[model samples]
Target: MSANASANSFQALVRLLRYARGYRRRIVAATTCSVINKIFDIAPEILIGVAIDVVVNQEHSFVARIGFTTPQEQIVVLAVLTFFIWAGESIFEYLYKILWRNLAQRLQADMRLDTYEHAQRLDMAYFESKSSGQLVATMNDDVNQLERFLDGGANSLIQVGVTVVAVGAVFFVISPLIALLAFTPIPLIIWGAFFFQRKAGPLYADVREKVGDLASRLSNNLSGIATIKSFTSEAREAERLRSVSEAYVEANRRAIQVSSAFIPVIRMAILAGFLATFTVGGMLALRGDLNVGAYGVLVFLTQRLLWPLTGLAEVIDLFERAMASTRRILDLLAVPVTVKDNEGKPLAEPVRGEVSFDAVSFRYAASGVGVESVSLHVPAGNTLALVGATGSGKSTLMKLLLRFYDPQAGRVCIDGQPIGEVSLASLRQAIGLVSQDVYLFEGSIRDNIAYGRPEASEAEVIEAARTAEAWEFIQALPQGLDTAVGERGVRLSGGQRQRLSLARALLKDPPILVLDEATSAVDNETEAAIQRSLAKIGHGRTVIMIAHRLSTIVHADEIVVIDGGRVAEQGTHAGLLEKGGRYAAQWRVQTGAMEESEALG
Candidate 1:
């Protein structure tokens, strides 16, 4: 590898080790087994040399010097020793496999879970900038890449190191000249491995990126399948997916070309080392300069030493891929959380739900379209409605209150306490939000309703569903509340999904409830049902509603008309109508349009 890239891979590995510090004891245990297993594995080669000595030297054998005088006795001794060596190898081999594989499973699961939790805590802006498929790829694919390396590659590397060191020591003690010549090609092999590593490093990284892109394309397509079918763009989407898939394949092909050449290069280098030991060691034994048993040891050990080096190509390939994945995974873990929870105090008990947006201003980093110095307040038990055209920053105000994106200027408070000074858990728990884009999990209606309060009783879930005017339709289904919602509630109608979302929020029973276009998806009858429910539901809790439909908020205690991220007007429904401004203009258009439809009917 180039010094710079090698250093980066090394740094990435170091970072991974630091992150895995919790598993240090398990790592040490696994590595100890690997090293001990290699020792026992190499012992059999030594035993073969000793058995050769017993056959040729008899009484003059090395074992005879150690007090076993007969060749038969020494042979039996070697047989028994071989059995134990092989047994030890088997035992430790099993041990290390269990240790390393279990470690990989546990570490990968923990890393994925930790990464997901951290991602959840990140600000909404971060999610807006990233694709869901890319995040899933990192959490699943990249983490699995690391697990595959740990499962086998790590043990291979450790055993290779042991083979080189243990065999090299034996070679030097037997005949330094043979050892020098036999070891000559090792430097070349090492250099070539690193050289290919440098080339493969960047290519593997590109392969990973291309895989992420492919994942993103797939995720986007699957999620929008209905849209593609409706628009008859299935063929176009298939072509797009094919393009991304081809890009991933091409990247893999490039990486394979470089990694595949390493094995052949290493094999030639190993050949040089093997031939040197064979020729020179045979010459030495013929000249009586080397003991026969030791010379035999050198011949066998030469292959044992150099053959493992050839496998370095595969090990290095695995290492490079792992390091690439590690860098991406750790880089995600290192992303600074801009919206930190400061571990601040919780909100006061019996949260009165008095909410205020004090001169709040926020601009989207990419679009620069957000609220501009907007401010408003809603007293406890009061309903305040936000009216605006689409993209007029109505929902941005609600997001600020929820701390999804902190305002660039000013503060949002509940119960006269600034939200930024409170713990995120406490602040969020105080409010329940049902957004314009309703989302339902792929589960039963009851499960979705009780999601925010899973411990809630069945009676409680039923009441929340009833309050959202969803219980009637839910009862009509064959499975009733147990009916599957399907993925993102695709099985349900838009209005049904909307009601379920409202039911979920109501189940939470937060002190403050925020509904952003909660009834936008419903038919007129369902809308009237929800309106009547809201009249009763708002009796004890604060309600903040953002609506495009003027009729929905006609009875709100106060209505604030937002225009271009600023408050254009604010008053009670009757008062705003008398002012004949923005609110009045919007009301007339909506009501007049409704009246014409009624007359036509």
Candidate 2:
């Protein structure tokens, strides 16, 4: 397992490069420009050497052999060459910079979208076990960090590689003895880089993990700010967040402390090469074994070769950070989707909403809280209400029917076909869900209602709002349907949010509708209003209602009373009241003229 984990970490960047294969041509073009630019950038030192040769050698200089007889003409020709070289270098620099940065932006955007699409495909239980903030970090923060590296560090790496190779060639051609001394420090510098890489790899991965935890904490605090304010727990929440942020800072500090020491140590090693080139090349020139101009080139080129190694610290740091983030992003992509549609079976054509639970059972992996040995059926175009005290698994049963969590035992089928064998898209499309916890995106009211059907016409949106009994309240808002609803519909009252949630579901116009405690949080008047709306649209669609209020479901075609994850009674409300069982006891208490007793016997 340890070996496998090590292999996985090492392959993170390799996998990213494989992903880049789609844009290989762009990368190649950008990299070619970078290489050509560096070559021209290195030419200035050689130009200086040729200029030195023209001055010292005078008429018999290397320039004279190229047909320039006088020093003045040679100088002019040299200046022209210099102008074009610098221009060519600047041109390629511009091209590479633009190409690389734009490529980063495009790739980052695409990767984020693909990652989110994959996240949506995952089973509901996976999301339950994960935090939204951590997912956001993976999709946003980590991806942004990689884009930053691409914007600058990518060029630094390519140019530095070019400098090393080009400069080393010049050093050797001048004098092997001087070249050997100049080349001595390079191997040590490379070895140090690899050593730093080994140590910093795990530290950076931990840094990424720490930031994810911090993001999760921040997200939790922001979402619950209202609750925190009401409870006056600002100080406590802030301290909790401080503790998480401090941990993140400490993790980064450790990684920074290690990577920080890299530059100074590399500089010490670089001193060896620079001084040796300066001293040895001078001696070779004085001994008449090498020309003064060649010696000048060697001295200048040696610093060019070695000084950039100081920036090796930064490039290595960027590489490590990118690799760490890549692993996280890839790990999310690597997660096997446990729940998926089976091939060869589509939702039966002309889906009629006949949902059945044939002795189905399931339990939460973390809490072991779920329904067990439950069996019920909602026939086409009928209403079935589920009622029980809280935590009685009523909602869990509905989740199972929706295939949010498949039952561990038995089968859940729609229209006599197992849902697992049906295409997930078609099956889910045929069902519309509206729960008590209504979530609205930060957009106009019309957008929220048409979320499931983006192509829904404006008239259709208003019609659905009217059917949901939300049109009157919506018209009172300043912008009507165009009014922006704040995040999670925080700008709207509880009833308004619930009504909009209903409108969203109604707009889907599905054959099956599941209202899981949809009206539980609303006032009596709003609940009545929603009830009237439900009654109107309840026909022509199979409705599964989970409600705490007995009055709402009293007219249901059937009522199922759940107790401890199992059905204790299943009958019409009138029949259950006549039998004087658990449902009857609850009904009596809710309608009692005396002091309230137990809620559900």
Candidate 3:
């Protein structure tokens, strides 16, 4: 790896460690167990050397020097020590495996939850710019990648380190000349692992990106299945899916090619080290310069030390893959939150829904299409309607009031208090919104209605449904309010879903209600029913309506015509028609079209 890339990888590891600081005690315990187990694991090789000395050297053996005089006694003592070593290895192996695997499970779960919650609080603009599938990939696939490494790769690396250090110490003490020749190839193997890492890192990163693109294509196709079928484009969609899947496969193939070449090169390097120790130690023992038993220990320990280095290629592959995923997850957590909720006081109690837009201006960064300097106000209990052509910024005004996007140039106030100065939870709780693009959760009719107030009594849910003129249709279903809504309410008609959305907002019973083309999806009869209900319910609460249907807002206490993000006109319905401006021109066109349809009928 380049020095810079290596530094960044180290930084990522450090950041990850800091993130998992809560599990430090468990990490320490697991690591200690792994080291101790590896020490015991290498003891059997040394025992074989001691057993040979007992059989060949008899009273002159190393064990005899330790006070076991007879060859049979030395052999018996060696057997007992070997048994205890193997048992210790087994016990600590179990302890480390369980500890590492449990830590992996817990850390992954906590990281996913924290990342999801942070994503939820980000501003609407952030979501608009990102795809849902990419977010899902990070939360699920990327997090699982880190978990897999922790499950086994971490233990393998720890043991490899302990093996090299413990075996190298024994080699140098027995015969420094053999140890020097045997360890000569160690630097070359270490360099090769890093060389493969530098080459494979970018390839693995490409593999991860392809996975996200494949996920995005699948998510979009599944959500729009009805459209594809209606157009009879199933074959085309299938081909598109195949293309993305193939790209993912190609990316993985490239990464595998690079990682696969590392092991063969590493195996050759390991052979050089083992041969050096075997030939040199044998020559020394023949010359009587090295003890025979010590020469035997060197031969066995050489293989034990060098063979594990061959597995380094696999361990490095896992490490690089996991570090790629870790960087993605951490990048998501670092996204700046533009709409911060930390610096505001709670909105005052008994929020009287007096709302004002004071010379407000907000333009979307991507499209530069938004409201200009617009100003208006609604009294605490009055009804105000907004009328505009498509893309004229009528909805933008409402978004500003909700603080979905703060105005770039001016202030939005509710109950005479600047909304940006109030806590987001209190500000949003004070207003209820029922938008034209209605969404229903996959659950019962009663659950959707009571979503805004889950603890509401059954009687209250029924009443809210009745007020929205939805109770009759709900009752016609076999399960009444208990009937399932399926995904995004696919089981219900468009009109039925719209009413349920309204019912949900009504149940919240906020002091202010905003309806953005709320009745646009319903039939004429249902629209009339909802209109009548609105008349009854609009008595005391403030209502802000955005409508393309001019007839729906004729009875509003005041009507404002928005043109190019500015207020073109404002007055009561009768007064605006008398003025004969933009509002009058649109009213004439809509009413004339209705009259001609009536005459034809």
lDDT by residue (tens digit), candidate 3, 9-72: 6677888998889999999999999999999999999999888878889999999999999999
Better of 1 and 3 by lDDT: 1
**Candidate 3: misplaced stretches above 4 Å?**
1-5
What C-alpha lDDT does candidate 2 achieve relative to the native structure? 0.90
Residue-level lDDT tens digits of model 1 in 267-302: 988999889889888888899888888888888998
Off by over 4 Å in 2: 1-9, 66-69, 342-346, 593-601
lDDT (10s digit) by residue, model 2, range 1-601 = 4344345556987898887789899889989999999999999999899899899997988899989999999999999999999999999999999999999999899889988999998889889999999999999999988888888888999999999999888877778898899989999999887777777788888899988999999999999999999999999999999999999999999989888999999998999998998997888788988888898888888888999998989997898898889889988988888777676667888988999999989999998888889999889999999999898999998888777877899999999999988878888888899998999999999999999998999999999999999999999999999999999988999999999999999999999999999988999888988999998899889999999888889989999999999999999988999999999999887778333444444
The lDDT for every candidate, in the order shown, is 0.91, 0.90, 0.89
Ten contiguous residues with the weakest lDDT in model 2 = 592-601
* TM-scores vs. true structure, each candidate: 0.98, 0.94, 0.97
* Clash count in backbone of candidate 1: 1
Q: For candidate 1, what is the lDDT?
A: 0.91
- Comparing 1 with 2 on lDDT, the higher-scoring candidate is 1
Which ranges of candidate 1 are over 4 A from the true structure? Answer: none
